[model samples]
Target: MGWCSCINLFPPSCQLSELKSTMYERQKKLFDSCQRASKVVAYRLKTPPYKLDALEPYMSQRTLELHWGGHHRQYLEYLNRALGKNDILYGCTIDELVKVTYNNGSPLPEFNNAAQ
Candidate 1:
């Protein structure tokens, strides 16, 4: 019923609190979307911008070769393969797939990299 009680100028503190609340809500939604994107998004092979030999003084090319060329590449291959079978989950974000496969807190038998 006061000056700011619903129809007039809101106090600075009240306005600030409202602004913070709005930002928090928006940020939370964004975070959730990112999480969901992980599953739905196809695995992309990413390499460092610098040449493999550039960091050789500290980082070895062999390490990069194995990590990027072998492990990471392998992971993507399997993820794609798995996605191929499940039309529903394939399009769904990783977050959704994980939740569905989680079986209401109980994980499915297939721990084949999908769980990770």
Candidate 2:
């Protein structure tokens, strides 16, 4: 028999199209589960308890502003972007988000953002 004819020799379950469909269904289920688990929530940056200049001589105002305002805020922005409104991790606490995105050491794309 020709190469094309050999495809029919295999059972329907073993066919390439069937395999792809099965994989697609599994992915769709996962996506749906994530969607169902998510809740809408807003994340905000917390202000430091003390004034930025409180630690003067020990830590400069400019340094604190750069680190807290610039870097920390940027990290939060990136995290919010990564965990878009409908994301599975959306509305999760920072600690929980970090742990989940860590993915048992495999680490998802949002792990860094969550950890930061």
Per-candidate RMSD, Å: 14.5, 7.6
- Model 1, poorest ten-residue lDDT window? 30-39
Q: Per-model C-alpha lDDT, please?
A: 0.61, 0.71
Error of 2 at 25 (Å): 12
Model 1 clash pairs are 39-94, 40-93, 40-94
**Backbone Cα, N, C clashes tallied per candidate:** 3, 0
Candidate 2 segments whose C-alpha is farther than 4 A from its true place: 1-40
Where is model 1 more than 4 Å wrong at Cα?
1-41, 93-116
Q: Report residue 72 deviation for candidate 2 (angstroms).
A: 0.5
lDDT of 1 at 111: 28
Write model 2 residue lDDT over 11-113, tens digit each, in one string.
7578888886765565345444553345547556799999999999999999999998999888888888877843556667676667666756778777886
Return the top candidate by lDDT: 2
